[model samples]
Target: MITFAPGPSKVFDQVGQYLQDAFQTGILSANHRSAAFMNLYQETETLFKEKLHVPEDYKLLFTSSATENWEIIAQSIVESSSFHIYSGSFGKKWYTFAQHLNEATGSHKLGTEDALDVAGLEIDGKHDLIAITQNETSNATEVSQELLGALGEKYPDKMIAVDTTSSMGGIALDFSLADIWFASVQKCFGLPAGLGVLILSPKAIAKCESKGESGRYNSLSFMLENAKIYQTHYTPNVLGVYLLKRSMEDHPEIQVTDALVRKRMKELETVIAQSKKLTMLVQNSETRSKTVMGIAGEELFIKEFKKAAEQAGMQMGSGYGPLKPTSFRIANFPAITEQEFENLLKFLKEY
Candidate 1:
């Protein structure tokens, strides 16, 4: 069946084989501290740096998933306050996690969530840090480059973090503007779940080292220290790492200037326009994510579309938040071919 769900969507043929081969070679059975495992781990980090155009000063750390990274950031980096910029559920969730962490650690009253009225809102440079989700998978919303740059200018003293979970590999990321940028490989990377890629700036590292009194495991300082030598403090999803490494190796090019990405987006726009029963969810094109498109239509249309599509061999994503009743999502990642898209459109038309 075709999977148009946001993540754990698809994997390259080679990535699948790599997992099978790894199991056969007993690489999955070897100790995590062994030289062989360390070499593989280091190579994966190197590949990430090359593919993500991650700055030399920034460090990369792999975790279980983006959910775990949220706790890591909340526990290690957020001590006093964080001005969270929220446009969707993921961003709101991160802010909630920080609030809970603050209450648990008693780390000086944490900050409140700022309403994401992009035009009227201004970044208060007073907070300890600024957090924004680069791409919102749930709503197919994105914080624009202009917004990030403006915030950086106003909040030079505060560190900035981004959740790029759905945008990495599918878009060009400017890590220079944000202190921490992270993603999960399952979405745009065309791999399975269980691996989250996190990159940290020097300033973020300093904050972690200073505020990491929250304890171990979720400590960014510990992750950073071990990452220096290419390792994780705890046992990692070794097979997921192998698939990530193989996927990166398979597509070494970092810059995602694919004409096809643009072409498919345009095609989707045309399709969206023609369907009277359906409409693109996000109001702003500037903030719409290229990787995932949120579609809102008649509830009957969605229910019928979902049921018919599944019978005809398609798997569309359920809505993430309050929109679950009226909205669905479409993934336009690299692995989805033009023919497949045409088929999807045809199915939609028929249904």
Candidate 2:
């Protein structure tokens, strides 16, 4: 089945052949620190930086998943105090994690409130970090870059960490404004699960250093120090890393630019606009994610839509959380073909 599920949706065609060759070539079982492995690792990191347009000084760190990055950020950056902004289900999870941390370590969380209606946040220097989920995958909401810039500028002293899990590769992100940015490869990188890419500015690295020995595993400093030697603290998902490397290489910037993605998004906008029953979940176009588009239909229509798509050998995403059964999320990441988009539209029209 062609998976349109939010994550683990589909792998690149070339990536599959690459993975098969990987095992046959013995690169799958190669030592993490081997010369051949490091070459691939470094090349992957360099390609990511090039494609993502990350600043030269920023460093890319790999982990098991975005969830693991949550733990790493929670343990290392939250310190004794923080201010968390929550807009939707995923944001609420981060806030809940913070509350749990508060109870466990007696740490303080200040100005914790739902980010959906957050108009004005008063920032004091007391809070060590300010957490924001760049894109709310659950609710199909994204905080705009202008708002993020305002928050960062308004609170120069507050360290910022953002979760760009669902929208990273499909959208244009300004990594300079955020102290730390992380994403899961499954959603936008067109790869399988079990790998998360994290980019940290020098400021974020310095904050981790200030923590002073954050118990080995979840420490950003530890990852940074070890990554220099082309290694991970634990046995990294070497296969996933290699696949990610291959995917990055396969989709170069010269051929697939953000402008191309934006153009496709515009085309999708026209398609969505023409559909009477299939409206968008996000009211504001400015905040809509280019990669994932949530469609609003009745419960019966959603079921019909899914059934029809599956019968046609296509998979579509279900609305998450509060919108489940009322909507379907359509992922139009770069890896998806034009024919697939047409097929989805055809199915929508029939239902």
Candidate 3:
């Protein structure tokens, strides 16, 4: 099937070869502490930075999944408390998780259809970290980076943690706008879901240092110490790392891919706008996610829409969270080809 399930969405065409290369080259069996593994990790880190335009000074850390980083952040990065500003299920989940860890954790839910209005929100001053989900995958909305830039300026002392699980590598993210950024690879990286990438600014690193040793297995201090030598605090998914490196190498810089993604998103907007039976879940164009397009239809039509796509040899993404049964999603990631977009667009136009 032509998969587009938005996260484990669509594997890059070359991943099969990368997997084979991993086994043939013994990367699948390489020890995490071995020189081979270290070199592979270092090279992948370099490619990750170069491809995504992540600052050289910014540190790239790895975790099991974006979910794991939530704990890592709460445990290691937030010394006092975290204030969450969000609009979707994933963002709320992060807030709930933080609150579970630190009772003082706070939240402000923005309108699902509005762009992030950081200037308007009354954020408490005592929170050490401000958590924001850059892309609300469940609702197909995004927090504009322009607003984030303004937030950073307003609270230079507060660490900004952004979860870009669905938009990372698919869009142009301003690394400097936030102190800590993280994403799981399955969505846009065109890979499996075993690994997550956490990009941290130097200020975040200092905060980790100030906390000293938390003695936790996934403490930023312990992870950073190992990461300095191109290693992990524990055994990692070697094949996943190798695949991410090879997949990223297959593409050009992020802007090139970002342009393609944006163009396709526009096409998606056009097709959905012209659809007699379908409408977008997000009304505001400014806040809609370019990578994940959630389409609303009658509940019956939603089921049939997915069924039709499946019969046509396409694996459409089902709706997430509460939107399920009435909405469906389309992933506009780089791994999906222009021809696939054309095919899907044709199907969409006809259906």
Q: lDDT per prediction?
A: 0.77, 0.76, 0.90
Ranking by TM-score: 3, 2, 1
Off-target runs (Cα >4 Å) in candidate 2 are: 103-119
Q: In angstroms, give how far residue 283 of model 2 lies from its true place.
A: 1.3
Point out the higher-scoring one by lDDT: 1 or 3.
3
lDDT string for model 2 (314-344, tens) is: 8888888778989878776766766776666
> Comparing 1 and 3 by TM-score, which wins?
3
Compose the digit string of candidate 1's lDDT tens values, residues 150-242: 777767787888898988888777788889888898888888788898888889888888875545776777777777777788898888888
- Residue-pair clashes per prediction, in order, are 0, 1, 0
The residue ranges of model 3 lying beyond 4 angstroms of the native Cα positions read: none
Residue pairs with clashing backbones, model 3? none
Q: Poorest 10 consecutive residues of model 2 by lDDT?
A: 105-114
Query: For model 1, which pairs clash?
Result: none
Candidate 3 TM-score to native:
0.98
Total backbone clashes of candidate 2, pairs 3 or more residues apart or in separate chains = 1
Whichever of 2 and 3 has more lDDT, that candidate is 3
In terms of TM-score, which candidate is strongest?
Answer: 3
